[model samples]
Structures are given as C-alpha cells and as structure tokens.
Target: MSAETNKALVRRFFEEVLNGRNLEVIDELVATDYQEHDPFPGQREGREGLKDRMTMLIEGLAPTFTIDDLIAEGDRVVIRWTNNATHSGTFLGIPPTGRSCRFAGIDIFRMDDDRLAEHWHVVDQLSMLQQLELLPSS
Candidate 1:
C-alpha cells in the first residue's frame, strides 16, 4: 500500500475505533495476529486483545482524540496525538476520579496488507496521573 493509504488505515483506528466508539471496526483495520509491542499491565494478546483494550479505554476515559501529526514511510505510520477526556469509569485499577484530563502520545504502527499488524506507543501517563491527583506533581 502507498504511504498515504497506510496512514489512513492507522488514522481510522484512532478516529473511528477509539474516539468514535466504533469498536467493531477493529476487525477491519487490524490483523488477526496483531502484536502490541507495549501492552498494558494485564492486557491480553492478539486482535481480540486490542479490541478489549480499546473498549476499556473508551469506557474508562470517554476520550476524544485528535491526530496531531501523521507521517508514513514504507509500511510504518507514526502518529502524534492528544486526547481530552473525563475519568468517568475505572481504568488500570484507578477508579473514576470524575476528573477531566488531557494527555498526548505518539504511536507507530506497522501495516501489513492494509491492516495494522504491529503497534508501539509512548503516552504521557505521568502527566495524566498527576492531573488526576493520583500522583504528586514534581
């Protein structure tokens, strides 16, 4: 697939699947053997695992995502993004703080035949935790 096409595929995963609450699209956008290079604590594995993770975040954070930047080359797409959300539901053993939070992250996705085959990401968890008053700010 072309670089633009690869970027589009990854964008859909964020725009549609995560932000839009269209979790079903995961099957369409992700490979069945999908691999998350950095899985969260206690997260499962494979396509189903990815779907489960998305569901958890969407429910927990009720986040609205914005794609800040998208760059693609070969089969890899790198996306810089931010999300603003409310802690309306539990996430990662942290109960809902009813606190609003904003955070940013960068994710790199590897495309295989137009589907996302692998993913790696770095999210500003410290900022989010501190904003929620779950951790002391330095």
Candidate 2:
C-alpha cells in the first residue's frame, strides 16, 4: 500500500476503533499476529492483546485522542497525539477516581500486506498518573 493509504488505515484505527469504541475493527486493521513492542504489564498477545489494551483505555479512561500529526515513510506510519480523558473505571488495578487527565503520545506502526503488523509507542504516563492522583505531582 502507498504511504497515504497506510496513514488512512492508522487514522481509522484512531477514529473508529479507539474513539468510536469499535473493537471489532481491530480484526480488519491489525494483523492477527500483531506485535506490540511496549506491551503493558500483563498484556496478552497478538490482536487480542491489542484489543484488550484498547478496551482498558477506552472503557477506563474514556479517552478521545486528537491526532497532532501523521507521518508515513514506506510501510511505517508515525502518529503524534494528545488524549483527553476521564478516569471513569478501574484502570491498572486502580479504581475509578473520576479525575480528568491529558497526555501526549507518539506511536510508530509498521504495515504488512495492508495490515498493522507491529507497533511501538511512547506516552507521558507520569503526567497522566499524576493527574489521576495515582502519583504525586511535582
């Protein structure tokens, strides 16, 4: 697929799957044997693992991401995003605090045969945790 097409696929993942709460679309967008380089602790494996992780964020934090940028080179698409969310449900074993948080993240995804094959992510988790009262603010 072209770089534009690869970017579109990743955009759909953010819009439909994450914001729209449509987990089923993961089957279409991500490879069945997907690899997440920064898997959260206790995260499962493959597509299901990705789905489970998304579920936690969507359901727990009720997040909505604003894509700051999408840059594609070859089969890789990189996304820079900011998320605004509320702690509405248990997340990472912490019960709901009903606090609101904002965080930024960058992710790189590799496409293979038009499916998302692998991913690497970096997020400002410390800020988010502090906002959620899980960590002391500096």
The TM-score of candidate 1 is: 0.97
In the order shown, what is each candidate's alpha-carbon RMSD?
A: 0.8, 0.8
lDDT of 1 by residue, 21-57 (tens): 9989998999999999988677789999998789789
| Cα-based TM-score, every candidate | 0.97, 0.97
* Clashing pairs for predicted structure model 1, backbone only: none
Off-target runs (Cα >4 Å) in candidate 2 are none
Predicted structure with the largest lDDT when compared to the true one:
2
Query: Candidate 2 lDDT, tens digit per residue, 24-64?
Result: 99999999999999887778999999998998888799999
Candidate 2 CA-lDDT value: 0.95
Candidate 1 lDDT score relative to the true structure: 0.91
